[model samples]
Target: MYKHLLVAVDGSHTSENALDHAIGLAQGENAELTLVNVANPTEYMALAPEFLQHESYEAAALSEGNSVLDEAMKKALASLPAEKVHRHLLVANKGVKEMAQLLVDYADEQKTDIIILGTHGRSGLMHLLMGSFAETVMRETNLPLLIIRSDGEA
Candidate 1:
């Protein structure tokens, strides 16, 4: 029933699972698929300057993000036409916004019917420390969300 499907991909197995579900949904519903990857350079901001400079960190992050998108696109093309699939490489604004917020805003901007995210399903201590992007988006967005977990433990 979706017209536009938005999926977050990070080149992880969890992300791959999410993408597979998105692709199946898009094919079954004849919807357009949008793949998004957000590269947040802020993760490295706390590192020593000598270890990784600002420019280098951002460049590496963007490069990796692009690679992730490219691979996802390749997989998508196997089942969907190039014209029906789209990809966006997003860079998180340092200190201004978090990655989850960026994804929510982009979904709003695109008027996507649903957001599909893959969760590592971390719990307890790890969950508290790293937090959950899927959970955050679920709390902030009004749209439908499909969460695919990498493991069943969660």
Candidate 2:
């Protein structure tokens, strides 16, 4: 029953699963699909009191992130209907901490009916280091979320 579906991807296998699921649903429902990737602004990492900014590192990371996302999108769209797929790349620090909310904002802007994403299934130390970006997104955003977990479990 979805009219517009938005899939938030990060080039991970879990995200690929989510993309696939979203695509299948879109194809079945004849819905439009939009893929989004948020490039976290690298400036915040250099916010320490004494450290100078690392321009080169940030630039390189941005470039790499964009390239990876582009490739992932290409792969995801290869088997999907051409007229139904759309893509957007955004750079915002808000996404890093509020991925679900960020997706919801984008969906609201696009009037999308659903948001799809892959859950990395991380816990303990790993989650402590990177935190659950997806969980935060899910908690803060206000949209129907279809989350596919890694290990092809969900």
Ten-residue stretch with the least lDDT total in model 2: 49-58
Reference-based lDDT, residue 131, model 1: 85
* lDDT per residue as tens, model 1, 12-103: 88999999999999999989999999998776667788877436778867888999999999999999988989999888855323788889
Clashes within 3 Å, all models in order: 0, 1
Residue-level error in angstroms, candidate 1, position 23: 0.6
Measured on C-alpha atoms, candidate 2 has an lDDT of 0.75
In terms of TM-score, the best-performing candidate is 1
Q: After superposition, how far is residue 134 of candidate 2 from its true place, in Å?
A: 1.5
Model 1: worst 10 consecutive residues (lDDT sum)? 89-98
Report the lDDT of model 2 for residue 43. Answer: 41
Model 2, 1-154: lDDT tens digits are 8989998877778887888898889888889889887766564465663453346545544665677678766865776767788888766655367544566688889999988888888889998887886788777777887878898454
